[model samples]
Target: MDHEKVNILLVDDQPAKLLAYEVILKDLGENLVIASSGREALEVLLKTEIAVILVDVCMPELDGFELAAMIREHPRFQKTAMIFISAIQVSDIDRLRGYEMGAVDYVPVPVVPEVLRAKIKVFSELYRKTRELERLNQELEDRVRARTAELENSTAKLRESEQRRSMAIAAGKMGSWDWDWITGDWMWDEGQYRIFGVSPESFEVNPANVQALLHPDDVDQLRKAIAEFNSGTRAYETEFRIVRPDGEVRWCVGTAAATIDANGRVVRVSGVTVDITERKRAEERQNLLAREVDHRAKNALALAQSIVRLTRADEVKAYVNAVEGRINALARVHTILSLSSWQGAELSKLIDEELAPYSLGGQIRLAGPEVQLLPATAQTLALALHELFTNSAKYGALSTRSGRLMIAWQAENDRLTLTWEESGGPLVRTPKSRGFGTRSLLASVESQLGGQAQFDWRAEGLLCRLEVPLTRKTAASPAPGKFDAAAAAELQRASG
Candidate 1:
């Protein structure tokens, strides 16, 4: 767009009319280009960017209509304003034709300079504003192009940074999450889905589904942590256990912070989680071993005290032998328990250890279904068997070659029933008082095991019947015992 004074083209075949137009429009402060014919006007149009054109209606080869039509045909001059001036009156059709050729107005004979100047002024101003608007639009487009290039460069750098961060997260096997504070909706990354043992596509990400992965024991603690975070009392950092879909319980450590708005209200919470199952299991094993050491120490002390308090001997030598023998019986049970990590001892093994000396002798007979007893029960039962074995060897059944002993046991619900029957020995009668051996046997079964012990002296033999509970809850007072599923399975196998 040119900022110079707008060019106004005046075309007339007669030089007089051309001079008249020039003089009239001269004060309008515009450049007037004169052409003697329609052809001359087109030549002037090519040289200058014209604002308006006033031409005579009658001409030799190219009239005003033809010149206007020719100007309008050019793309550059399509908006150039046109006005027709003629000495002869124009018909309505001719006026309309001039208008159709894009003429702005038609004046006959002498022209009014004021009206012509006013019309030219109006068109010139309109062209100036249109050019100014085009200039502004081009400037805006240039700025947009420059800004778009800068934005493209920034976007490329951002994508590279995100890729590097994603690789780092994957290599670490760490999970990340965002939780909407108000909606309870969850957004989890691929690593988070992996940690929870779920497929990203298959599961809906939500707080309720995440809670489903939490171990029942850890749910309350998780809630408390969330409450503390909500109250701004703590940044969320806690350890918890999650039960995977496959029933594996895994430990996890999570750390998070709440995003707050300007009003100090929570906007969202975001965090990282890591699976620490292996570390947690190692710690649990260490604790378990510690507990086992403590339990074994207490048990050893209790057994030693019981032995010293209960033993009744005539001499120091006899007392030492008695204590040693009881201790040896306990040690044998310990050996059996060691094979099973001290979970329990087998009843059959306990019996066999007490009767080892008499095992080869035809006088001893053992018959019983397989039964498993708690370590405490096995220990006491072993001592009682030892006392019985000693008695039978001295006066009951095993003292004679023809004498025989029969031991059998059965288990039902929580109780175990064992019978010791002796026969073919010297005639036995009911004793008036109990001996140290008898008293020890009674105390072991009745006091220590919290069971019933009975003795029957018949003419041919001595019979003993012991009823005890198979679990450790029978000791002291009744309580829930740690039931060994493995032991139960062994019993089932034996029965089968």
Candidate 2:
């Protein structure tokens, strides 16, 4: 018999991409449908059956994630495979969200022909298998109904119907069981044997055999549920863990109903058992993510509070500007962190952003290896850089057209040393007294970051050197946020 082709849907605002996808998948011998927008995609999906969907992540009106979520809500499309393609970097959180929204896979913008074709082929085959299984189940139900109505069927026909029923049930991870309490008799189907990791030819239908495969910790819960059912509970549902013969533990849930005799005594019980190991694992991961979000929120609030509390200004305008600048710096760093799923950010990118206004022309020079700063370290550095940038614009190298600033850094032996050298500006001189700016700068480096900062006053300009302790692993763990007044005062006094 000639096989019917499964339809593959391609969605993107760009026609070029849709055309490319069509060419790549045309050889698979599947029917391809192209849609330029999400609304159009939905219309096509409603009209025709789709085995797989390839959608662009960044689109007008509806993005790939929103499209996937909507499609998943439709019962007919819940099992359809969806692949998300994006040009932007996918963070850990974004990848997790994609999976949660029913995305089967993710592909980068520059599509690999071989990889894309292989993934689509696999899902398409799976779709065909699922359709076949559904057809088999429908046939089995039909045969059973026919046998029930016409009880005069031949023995061979009856045997074929029984085989169909068993095959249909064996294809799924669920099974039915029956227990006769009155006669100490039990019965299980082929599906039940597969669920318990055993074969019908080697398995026995008895309480001892069933209990032996149950996890030790969950045995009591199961027995308690049985006791409750015995004590007049008509129906009850409970969960337990099954320890398979291969030493793998899997979670299972069952709903059973008691069959009462004429005198109100239990005679038999029947129910369906389902494997739910993946669901349990998803729940655990969600709990962990919740805790991590809470931790990050607290860290951000602490950093913001410190910035607002320690900032000082002589006038209302100055105070507002100072507070705003510091918070804006924090916000910039937060954006970079979000792109990396709150991981560390590169040192060069952070400096370029903080000094964007003064970065016009060749005034700002930077020399450093690619260094990823811990998220906390980046926050601390952002606020401190804001102070330095502000000072430079008002009184340092950036204030003059002919002036220049050179920023350099070196990382060696698990430490990062940086310098800010300003030249060709007004002559520099040592101040007679320590001001709020000096104290604030010292505290940012010495207290929150646990780093060292040294100032040099020259006739031409000023140069500052910083030594920070950093490593890759330190990104997740942060230093204390509280500012130390005594330490800041001592550093300021010594510097003066």
Candidate 3:
């Protein structure tokens, strides 16, 4: 629990200033790093766990502002606090820019040693408090885990005790009978007569009587299970159908254990039998329900696949190759959804996989932050990328060997911006008419992703931009429909 060894980073172009600050804060008991240049400061920050950075604004080759910007851009260094020290007077705009670049405070130079030391102490105390809180939280978690383990152990013991009590009560209420092979005799308990629905005085203990009471189909299995138990090869647990003298059939569960004489010869086999007709019926019902559920799920998936296949069928032979290809795309989306437990898809990876074929040969470039997409967003984006790839392959950048395309996206403050740029295709001119592919992309982006789509047909190439809000992504999604005929016509007319 040593709180005195907190790490601090000091960046200044002047050696004298560095030494002066270090001397003033010597009593604070911190490990202070002094760098004479911004580059040197960055090197120090990279190698160490820096609690705070005190930087000089004016320096050669990456000044404080530039260095701060670099730090903010890096995900690992995003949370590091920066304090700027400058001798020159800074305007309101300059101060605002510093704050925008993630500077937490500004210290004027020709510095006061006492005031600087006190500021350093305040930051050091805050860092210590954060570390202390983290330690306490970890301790609390460990205690909770121990308590949970004890509760689980107690619950297991209680379940085991309950099971033993249930088994004893079941044995007492039911009945048991035994057969002595060596003595060639049979015996039955009082409860056994009750189970068979017979009076003890009317029944005689004999093999013939027992055989007559058992259902014919279960006689062989019942004998086999008993024989296996006597040979010490298996525990005796068997289910069979039994018939009463009055001709009523009932399901029964029988369990037996073997008794061996002194010579290691089987003396007798004894066990309990219980009526299990209700239990058997319940099991059958459960099995039927399970099969029905499995069948329905398969049919639903097949129906969805059929809908996708039919909708894309018209464009298959003329624009693409076959209906199977479109179906496969839909299947791939389904696979992604399944792998994520139907949660959604990762937007960047989805785009990369869908565009990989055309992206080869430097025809396309992709860049984006990692963001998860809802099911609707995933399907819409997949279809849009498909149309873009198809159009490019037929007449745009992907048609020529020398063409290039850049597909990039960025997420900023909960908004996502995606851009598609093309180059080195046929001489750029306005399209004569809007096509099905163009219309699909626009409608899908707007309605499915809750986004805006803009098309720019510049002389250099065709550029498409989309902007979307990230909040619309959800776990459960509604079905996405196809683009209307009017939108398709509009795209065709604009292009023509």
Candidate 4:
């Protein structure tokens, strides 16, 4: 196969040897540069990109080793291979030093011209293959980049077409608006003006005028949505309140997509708006009904848990019967809150009922911030606390007349921490084997509450600590009114 041209630098002090090498390698089809001295060779190398160098070891000013060292020092010629030629018999150490100076081979002079030519041919072929491979790799990379850019453009166009279809569908049912960010112009479908209860001719649909129609409380949220889309941080899907021309406040869902220029500047946002006043009212009613059902289900589950706890108490009849009785008392408190719709249960009421069964004239002490527990969390927590109370009443603090139980809870930064400490009870130590109640407590705290639970069976008494995320409890609370459907679809298409 044909090979790319290789530039060879042949350095020698003797003119006869240089001419002999040139004549021998003339058939190799490579470009050869001849230098009579080490200084002349260095000058030739500075001007030409030579792939290999053949240098005479015995030179007057700079020897082959010294010239090789200089070539290796220059980063541009660092990888260029050097071969040392010498008339003197090369020593093992001297040959080692020449190789260390980056000589690939050594040729004894009074040279074999054919052997020298063959070595040059091998190196030239290798260099040609390397260059061809690099060229192919660069071409492959260019093609891959071009293909990737084409795919991205096609994907963007598909998404834009899908968004336009969605806007058309939404427009058939409700109102729609398309904003041209480049020109600061807004196009509104007829339904949009009708939904806003405004004459299409009266309004010049633009972001500034749209802001004027938004409820004061929702303006900030709408602005934040637009800002997120424009910054490419997120697509816009915001619900905000818009006041109609008739002076009535209505909820509107806004959806929008940002179009970017080649330089990635936001050029436009296109989307649709929808009216969802009736849907919002229906959702509110459904939420109320769901909360009621959840409360009742929690109460029923609590009762069932109490029954199971009491039945298991007989299986270990050798232990005290007070464990089962205390569990029943906890269930009764859960039932009372369930009857009231589980908005929340008072902390004091929960404690009072759970301890009523183990009362030696109200010896248990409860203190800390008075907070209500959400229905689901309160039910599981009550059961876990009931188990702890039962264990204390039988084997630890609440078992004796001098024993006392302290229950406390606090909320901070969306986390609720509850601690149970007992004093003046029987000496406590870690159990040899964990019981069902112990496993239940760990599971309830870790799985349901999404928090950590610590149980320390210290010599003083049994201490239990629990931490739970508070967001699960307060999600039912209503927030300020915002947009509904039409604005949401509009924002979605604009963002898409």
Candidate 5:
């Protein structure tokens, strides 16, 4: 049925009759094979596809009925149409026999050329349509096979991509979620249940249920974010706290986008979330440290300025030395305070640092129980001690090699009293004027340390006493000093 060419076999004993049959069907544009005997016709049938066979009923050796029977016996030609042609009158019995042999039509001899051509034309058209239908069916089968392969390949690739995505999400501890806003339906993946500290089988994922799990302080903010998302004013990227079932609060960051319907209404929301509690805590600690450093740096700079302003000397170099020494004394106390995280400094350690530069083995003696002073108080006290030591080295007990000095302190009635006594040195007299060093010492003791200091010019040497509350109020941050021309002139006169 799918042959490239259709053949019509014409078998007869007379060549003239075969020629006449060819002429009649030649216009139909089909291959016409002529056979003088049934044997030749059989050969043509075996060699090519024959659409219709026209045979002479009275052929020699083999007749039309015999040839038709033989053709029908072959399974290959089972559907081949046969038309019998004869000049002799055909009886009903012979016609019935031809019909049984699969003859499609009986044409009497002296057959009308038009009738013959019409019959062949019908079979030719039927053969062409059958072959076309077979070709189309084959093409359709090929297409179905190709399409099935493509679909299978696509399904395999989709499965692989899903596997990779699942692995990535699991490794990152990320959770996915989906919400049907209109229906209040929520779906959470396995990771989400773990992050929320809940069993997925029993947890209700609606808005009210989820909100109940949120930290009380964060509930309002989260609601506002959701409201904005629902109003189409913002995409859902937010961070908030959730109180897990275990009573532990954790930080979570999530992002979601709404799916819009054809009517431009939000139908669903879906996104991913991650736990960020550790990161949040780390950020808080970092901020606190930064603030502490800023406060300390500002305080140190202000204290240095105050020292520079109070220092006086005849030359700039002398002034620099005085300021630097006082600042170093402050630095030494800071070093000790840093060990205690700036909580406080030990009083005895502070005294040792200030006296380190001028400590004479037998001359400088100190006695006091270890007491801690607040940071601001310790820094002020260190500067005062430095000034006192510098004056003693220049004009008091330590001015002479044989002079001796004793420093002692004791706490009583919630207050501390410190005595500075010098002996075996030149007689002391009250000075007619106070120098910058003496004024600075007095100002720092009262204004910075909230204490009182007194000096008695004794005949043997100078004696000083300091009285301060055991727990004096922490001094406020000092205002930065302005080292302008007027201040410089005032300091110079004080130095003189």
Candidate 6:
């Protein structure tokens, strides 16, 4: 739940006062953001969420009261708490102005530290709870991307004989059967005898014998189909298995209908059966492929979940933006794998797609041998590249007109090493703290793919190198540019 911590903004012109406020609130363990002036405070508010604002009443450029007014005008901050800290004496009108501008409380300077801390705690708790509730509601209403359905329309064949039964006949000579209730007799066509592996001369045709030949588990299915046909349905089609005299189990699709007299009494029944063993086998194969696809899709979603949980941002809007961008990068990789039928993807293709958003402008270069990556390798590598490209655009080579970037890679033995070099950008300085971007980059290259990530912060620019292990030599995930056997089995194992 600490992930739900809120930010507290302290605005003041004097550095000493800001330090004092920080000392008082540091014990609260919430994020403390300080701005030296009202304009700077407003900038912080624009990019970061502030559960409670501690503002100095008197400041250069923009005062606390004016800043509160501007903040309240925006719907997003209409209810955010503002506590004005004033050193001088306060009058009734001054208090009213602060209250009207969304001030929740006021602090007198040479302030009582305890009172300020207590006020901030209450608003921060309220803000965190509100955001949590909204998150839960959004999750409950979450809609899945898309779902595909395989539909097989069933139609009844028209009855052509005098008994007036109906069926949608198949192309081949289908085994036919008929029974008369009044005469208590049964008849079968030559095709029916051939299907049952029997001859009329050797075996007698009767309802009892026919029922005995049905697979034990499918007896109910046949009974149910006939029951439905007798219950005023014109025709019914059902698939079931049967045991022949030779003891062979064969799947059969039987279409049947009942003949009804004028008084609506069922008198005769007739139907046709077709050998559908091959079709049933085909259906089983299709089902296995569907499960493989399901497993692969879940793996991609799991990576997206990691990005959401691990990403860090100053504000809700920024957090959401970061997550969306990372997911889009993951989605593009999936799209590429899908186009290659999930066997594998070209390494150059993945790089090209990641670079498509940024124009070369004679500032970027790429050098790499043609390489192919297994499905899993391509996904993780795509995310790492996206992070690098996004960071460069924000603060490195791509951010400046005079800057330049070059990416090169080579495959040697069982490892692939890729280097990214930037020049002509702002002078490089190592950050004192590691942010989510840096951590995620390392995680993708090192933890995910069993690779090494080396970063060098030179005075002139930044450099990054990644050494990733190639896919193992396994039939499921073959060497680069190779796919054998059914990819479904390989993909399913990879997903696991």
Better of 3 and 5 by TM-score: 5
Candidate 3 or 6, higher TM-score? 6
Q: Model 3 over residues 278-309: C-alpha lDDT tens digits?
A: 77889998896576445435533543443343
Candidate 5: which stretches are off by over 4 Å? 1-205, 213-235, 242-251, 257-295, 315-317, 411-415, 470-472, 476-496
Query: What is the descending lDDT order?
Result: 2, 5, 1, 6, 4, 3
| Prediction 2 TM-score vs. true | 0.55
Q: Name the better of 3 and 5 by lDDT.
A: 5
The C-alpha TM-scores of every prediction are 0.50, 0.55, 0.36, 0.37, 0.52, 0.42
Q: List the residue pairs that clash in candidate 3.
A: 431-495, 431-496, 432-495, 432-496, 433-492, 433-495, 433-496, 434-491, 434-492, 434-493
The candidate with the higher lDDT, 1 or 4, is 1
Question: How well is each residue in 144-195 modelled by candidate 5, as lDDT tens digits?
Answer: 9899999999999999998887777777767899999899899999888888
Which candidate, 2 or 6, would have the higher TM-score against the true structure? 2
- TM-score attained by model 5: 0.52
| Candidate 4 lDDT over residue span 1-496, tens digit each | 6656889999999899888889998988899999999999989999998878999999999989999999899998888878889999989999999989999999896789888987887777777777788789999999998999999999999999978766765654467677787788999977677767778778888778888888998889976876786767535777777898679987778777777888888887777777877678899889978875664555455445434443333446643454555456556665857666656676666777777778786668777777777655665577677778877877899889888888888889878888999888888889997665666567656655577889898888888899987666322232211111222232233223
Worst 10 residues of 5 by lDDT: 478-487
RMSD of each: 17.7, 35.4, 38.0, 25.3, 13.2, 40.9
Ranked by TM-score, the better of candidates 1 and 2 is 2
Query: Where is model 2 poorest over a 10-residue stretch in terms of lDDT?
Result: 479-488
Off by over 4 Å in 3: 1-316, 319-325, 473-476, 479-496
What TM-score would candidate 6 get against the native?
0.42
lDDT of 2 by residue, 1-496 (tens): 3567899999999998889999999889999999999999999999999999999999999999999999999999998999999889999899999999999899997899999999999998899988999999999999988986676566667889888767766654788899998887888876777788998788887888899999999889778977997789889888889999999998889888899989999999998887778889999888876876776776677656655666677898998988888788889988988888767889888998899878877998999999988876887677677878888888888999888999999999878899999999887778776555656677767765678989887778879898887863432464332222333343445345
What's the lDDT of the predicted structure labeled candidate 4? 0.75
lDDT of each: 0.81, 0.83, 0.74, 0.75, 0.81, 0.80
